[model samples]
Target: MNSLLKVENLQMHYFTSKGAVRAIDDLSFELMRGETIGLVGESGCGKTSLGTSILRMPTPPGRYVSGKILVDGVDVIPLPEKEVRRNIRWQKISMVFQGAMNCLTPVYTIGRQMMETLNEHSDLSRSDAESLIAEYLGLVGLSPEIVQRYPHELSGGMKQRAVIATALFLKPEIIILDEPTTALDVIVQAQIINLLKKLKQQFSLSFIFITHDLALEAEISDRICVMYAGKIVELGSNAQIYGTQSPKHPYTERLLAATPRLFKKVEQLQFIPGTPPDLIAPPKGCRFSPRCNKAFDRCFQEEPPLIEIEPGHMSACWLHHRG
Candidate 1:
């Protein structure tokens, strides 16, 4: 059976005045039906780029150079932009973008923005569309009356709920949630995470949850993909990733070390020393080699392929690849 989403050796880059920046280089992954995959990485590691690439809607500076983004056995890259917008985008996949609370245009009321999506995607009558929008608002614990109000009128949590409600209104198969809970209070964050879990089960949705919080990711993600520099350095189940016995990838090991374990108290928290590599002129070998503690001759001279260390665990590191 075909995966819900399959991306093979996808390469996306930005053409800057200085040079080309490989925002996403040779990235590949799969998301099965109803599976939530957490994409965890430090900032500027192309997490957002990967999200935008799914809709084939990268911003002006960046472009999808090559690869296949197959959704349920259909390749989306070859489709015309207008066709994709009319059919695939939103109707099949939607994004609750980072700062989605601010996604609503200041000029349009919540109802109007929601109506815009419903009108453009489906042929539902005006009255029917408004009813559907109201129903979704109510489902997200928001009053139907709030649709007439503007974005500024609602509180932060309310705006986020409204945004999510809008994304779900069309009932897409896949949702890319990029930092969905950033800038929210702890209580509000937990509420949103719980809501997401409930919605996924209700809709049988596949989710690509991109965030830096591995702990939070572990709570919701069935599989976790750890990114470094412009590539996926490690991919595994939550248990394999958080395993105590296995050494794991050096990058993943440091990430786990840095994560705050509320129950397992540590003497002192750790940090990944040094900085991420420059994508514009990245090193020839492993992108994380400059910062890896286990770097050796092979690490400096040759890039490691992402190899499956076990049935479902894959890591891109010379140490794991060495025979």
Candidate 2:
């Protein structure tokens, strides 16, 4: 069977006066129907950039250099902006942005905003739009009465659910969730996570879950893709990523080391020693070489390609491809 989404050699950069910042560099991945791929990385690793580029909504100064964002076998890259907006975006794929409060318009009632979305995307009449708004809100565990309230009227969790509801209003098959549980309290975060799992099962939705939280990613993702300095360092099934076998990429290993694990005895939680390289002037060889404890002569002089380490696991590390 064909993949639901195929991103091949995707490159997105932010053009600045100084130079182009390679936010996404030769990235490639695929999302199958009903599969959740967790994109985990430190901030500035291009996780959000990848999400936005896939949606054909890269912010100003950011533009796609080359690559294909294939949704259901159709490439969205070469399409006209109008066509992408009218057909692809929010129609086949939708995004739930990072901050719920920031994404929602504080000036408008939640209902009005959702109604406007429905109007822009479909021929749904006001009655149909309102019904959808109510149904989606309820699906996200919100009340029908929430339509009357402004964004500020809702709690953090409620605001998040509202954003989720809006994203689902179009019934998109794929959803890119960017740090969906950012600032909410622990309880609300758990609720949101559970809700996402429920919705994924109910709708058979594919998700590109972007976040810095590895533990949370483990809870929701079927596969985990580790990114560093705008490139994917490791991509593997959850068992290969978080299970007994260790990560092949050094970056992945350090990231796992840094995360605090429950029911595990640890004298000290380790941290990756160095900061990520500047995207505009990333290191000459392996982007992670500057910080990789396993870096050697080849690591400093040659960039290793992301190669399959096993049947379903891929890693970009010289150690894995020494030949």
lDDT, model 2, position 314: 96
Give the TM-scores of the predictions, in the order they appear: 0.96, 0.97
Runs in model 2 deviating more than 4 A are none
Global lDDT for candidate 1? Answer: 0.89
lDDT of 2 by residue, 1-117 (tens): 248999999999999999999999999999999999999999999999999999998987999999999988888998998998788889889999888556787799988888888
Tens-place lDDT digits, model 1, residues 123-218: 999999989999999888899999899999988888999989988877899999999998798889999999999889888888999999988988
Say which candidate scores most in lDDT.
2
The residue pairs that clash in candidate 1, if any, are none
| Candidate 1, superposed: residue stretches over 4 Å from native | 245-247
The residue pairs found clashing in candidate 2 are none
